[model samples]
Target: MHSSTDTGPDDAVGVGAAVMLVEDDRRVRTAVAAFLRAKGFRVAEYDDGETARRAVLDAMPDVLVLDRMLPGLSGDDLLRDIRTRSDVPVIMLTALGASGHRIDGLELGADDYLAKPFALRELQLRIAKLLRHRASRQSPLAPFTVGRFRIDPSLRRITCDGADVVLSGREYELLLFLLKNPDRVVSRDEMLREVWGWNSGDASTVTVHVRRLREKIEPNPREPEYLRTEWGAGYRFTPSGRSS
Candidate 1:
């Protein structure tokens, strides 16, 4: 049976946003997709990692539900592949229950990983929290002046030291979030739920987006003048104007 709550849409959210569901389990896939559709989400179902990967390449979805194991490609492999190109949030669904494997998956770059035999309510809660977090980051409520970067949320534009720096929708959101928080360590979970939405629970989404953000706003994506990694903790943005 389908299970989800808060599927309702208001003036702020798109009622017809498309969600791509990739679960190899036929029964689960059918149930999840139907439930999501009932909640006003447009869903496309895929049964394999490879197919899901291809579909995402063709068109990015508003959300994703990816199974951890697939015949052609391992769920982890597909997760790695997605991170290489986009910061789309991912939540991994797996049958494995080992903490070690879960840790490995997070280290490999998943934003959030959920083992199989899960509850639909838990999944729904996670998805809702993640989407809301992401929307807030992307919204960019006001202009943020950070070091050499000045961001105008209304225009969805950014400039560095007076030079215009173009940003993709994802990049702008990631940068604005980091700048807004400034110097505080923003965890992977925070980035995933707030910046990318919990499409898939792979933390690598945060890394990729941060890397891309650095490339655009930082003086050097390598050294990262503005954005800095806090090792296992997460990341922080120290505006160039801020004194050490």
Candidate 2:
């Protein structure tokens, strides 16, 4: 039941952003929390999944740093719960460095993943990137429609055929990026750079999110009409909902 808040310096880069960090290891949590605080983020630290789950809604964090393993309710279970309730950005931390493990985390709705033994600076950068994305979504852009989907940027809401389509924060960003570039092939690397703010990363991350988006928007994900694979290339989004 360990929890505490560190209000970082007033002028730090991360100032005004709230970050919820759930990690069981005291040593790691303390170190990470301290570093984030120094960078000017309001960090709420938790030592286990169950406690973090209880505090999540109340905290309403800008970004969540969640460990893959935890006592009581596993991180995966907690993530599932979070997804059901909120689209708060999540960055999963795990000891597993395998690509499969990363894909699993991303598939489970994590906005980002960081393998253990990573540099503190890298983690901070990831958090900052997520914060930047969140901030960008708040921009007041005129609502637009492409085919059956209507996107209201001011509300960060999307509806398909007048029915609300719930999407994770990352999912919305990915879909919006594809919609903005309709009828054009967008490489995975380009998606990563433009959507995920990553210069280089596993293409599987983009693949997993694309699959998720298809399941939500396409009547039949097996034969996706909105998002189509380009095999040797990347992906093409068709606003007309027809394979071209």
Candidate 3:
């Protein structure tokens, strides 16, 4: 094994953050990525929303830069699909003619919108602002309290009855996802696509994350108090003292 340290910037494209750009045009992709990277970010480029979606799960970008017109999956469809699960920040880039598309993207779930033929500097600024805003908004809920546990997203810290608990990023994402949607039965596929963006069979990964989340957040760990399993479907987040 080898010891390591961060090679990326303090706010790496997504060290604790990332900006995912999904554009079909290579020119735009290169230009945008270079601009973002120049700004001290960890940037991931995708050609379309489908791939972007997968990357989003895998990389967990802090913000998504989505082009309105895509090849296989339309940007609108991707936005709608994303809304059903995660609330990762999204910014839509559309052609000037597609003004209606811009409005439509925001209606679905996009946090911000921009028209094409845009300035690289402006886009970089937009993504930066969104990421900063998202981070700020997250803290109040990061170390959220259930019955006895607290989830800390920043440090990936967890505490139960004031005792220290550690959680992996995947576990933190899955558990935080569920906690935000308390009392709901989240399906495995949804968790996969949203938490880690697994398009295929990754049930085991989901299981592992959930189990880890339970071990840290659950009071009994044997009989989980927060993360609950649904035999055939998936899992649920039960705020403490809630009955199954």
Please name the candidate that would achieve the greatest lDDT relative to the true structure: 2
Question: How does residue 82 of candidate 2 score in lDDT?
Answer: 96
**Candidate 1, run of 10 with poorest lDDT:** 5-14
Tens-digit per-residue lDDT, 161-219, candidate 3:
78876543344556667767788888999876665443444365566556656666665
lDDT rank, highest first? Answer: 2, 1, 3
Number of residue pairs clashing in candidate 2, backbone atoms closer than 3 angstroms, sequence gap of 3 or more or interchain = 0
Better of 1 and 3 by TM-score: 1
| Candidate 2 residue spans exceeding 4 A from truth | 1-12
Q: TM-scores, in order shown?
A: 0.62, 0.92, 0.51
Please give, for residues 1-244, the per-residue lDDT of candidate 2 as tens digits.
2223443332345576888999999988998998888777889999988899899867679889999999999999999999988889899999998999999999999989988888777787788777776776677899999887888998878888899988987898998898889989999999999988889888999999999999999999999888999999999999779865
Per-residue lDDT tens digits for candidate 1, residues 1-244, read: 3354443343234347666778888999888777666656788999988888899899987666678788788788887787666656566788887876776665445556678788775665656654665566554457778777788877777887888876555666777777778778888998866666654565655766677666766655787757788898988778773434
lDDT of all predictions: 0.70, 0.87, 0.67
Q: Score candidate 1 by TM-score against the native.
A: 0.62
Clash count per candidate: 15, 0, 7
Model 1, position 41: C-alpha lDDT score: 73
